[model samples]
Target: MYRERPAGFARAVLWTSTTAAGAAPTRVLPDGCLDLLWSSRGGLLVAGPDRTAYLSGGGPAERWVGLRLPPGTGPAVFGVPAVELRDRRVPLGDLWPARDVARLAERAEAVPAAVLAEVAVARLRAAGGPDPLGARVAAALSAGAGVAATAAETGLDPRALHRRCRHLFGYGPKTLARILRMRRALALARADTPLAEVAARCGFADQAHLTRDVRDLAGVPPTALLPPRPV
Candidate 1:
């Protein structure tokens, strides 16, 4: 089971998940977000923006809690470029000094469940705020705007947009747009929409286009992504 609620910080989601019985290995599809996770059993892990799926083994009764930071918010809070974390998960000690990481780990282990969110909120306040234009850029891409159009709307030229996207979303504007579109398609598909209609609604050229995008971004075919439906 998985559930998400507001993280009480700008541009973040607080989520928790428990593995189901006898589940096989699962892969997390990229949705252009970064995560800070705390496990009672696994400690702290920073999930970078994944260009492709992230795989992990699991079974029933494993509890996982996390705070997912939206694009552009991570650089300030994590003190690193978003690009550095692409397609990777790193221990906090790798990015910060050992003492700092140790102190953070101690704090996280104390509460078991809520400490990660507390750490995220404290970091948000300490960082002053998230990227001012982050929301606008994400909105434009999510709405299926082209990179050049997003650049024009955001008052940044194409080259500048590419640079900012790398720092903010861990990729270029085009790739971010692709990721967002695929996500849109996935949401629609999950609602039982036909692939042809899903493609059209999400700005794909056709069902075939949608299939290719899902394959490219998620490393799986479209059928493989849809969950089993009840009769």
Candidate 2:
């Protein structure tokens, strides 16, 4: 089964799958652009604007790779978990370079599941400890906690926090905080709260602030993205 939720910014989740689906993978680009790429259970290999291929796992082994992505001209795929792929905008070939999978197959198997799991755990630990900046930032944003207060709570200097955020999340601390705040607003919007109420509760300056942030992150107006309240 695969379920994806937009977690503010470009982050998302692809649930566990049992088979390798030859489908195009969908990703939110660095500039917040969204696109689909060819992927399988083995890993998610995608080429960036720089023409570099990146692979991340869709199964037990969460391995990632950075190399030249292969090209393919096919329909863009979406929605399926493992076995099937659906086409969307942009032909698959225009987006990806042709890859000789057989020749590069060995590199794909470089990291075992156990090793990957360990690495993930270790990385999580490090992220929470030495790299706790992202965690601290995420926590603060989730709780609507202020950046200054979060820095104090995490025992990190504000400047240090900023540095860590840039290194880990690709954005500065304030931007991440705003993104988190916007994420909360999206949740509240989906819950059918009034725009003003969502703005206030999410720490936005006002409804306009809420609208701007929501539109920036979700690619749609707040009203359009949010579902109607249950009658």
Best by lDDT: 1
TM-score of each: 0.92, 0.52
State the C-alpha lDDT per candidate. Answer: 0.83, 0.44
Please estimate how well model 1 matches the true structure, expressed as its whole-model Cα lDDT. Answer: 0.83
lDDT tens per residue, model 1, 1-231: 779998776758888877755677677888788888876566788899988887764655566788888877887677788899998888877887889777877887666457777776777788787777777899999988999899999999999999988898899989889888888899999999999999988888889989999999898988899998888
**lDDT for position 70 in model 1:** 86
What range of 10 consecutive residues in model 2 has the weakest lDDT sum?
A: 68-77
Report the number of clashing residue pairs per model: 0, 12
- True lDDT of residue 53, candidate 1: 82
lDDT of 2: 0.44
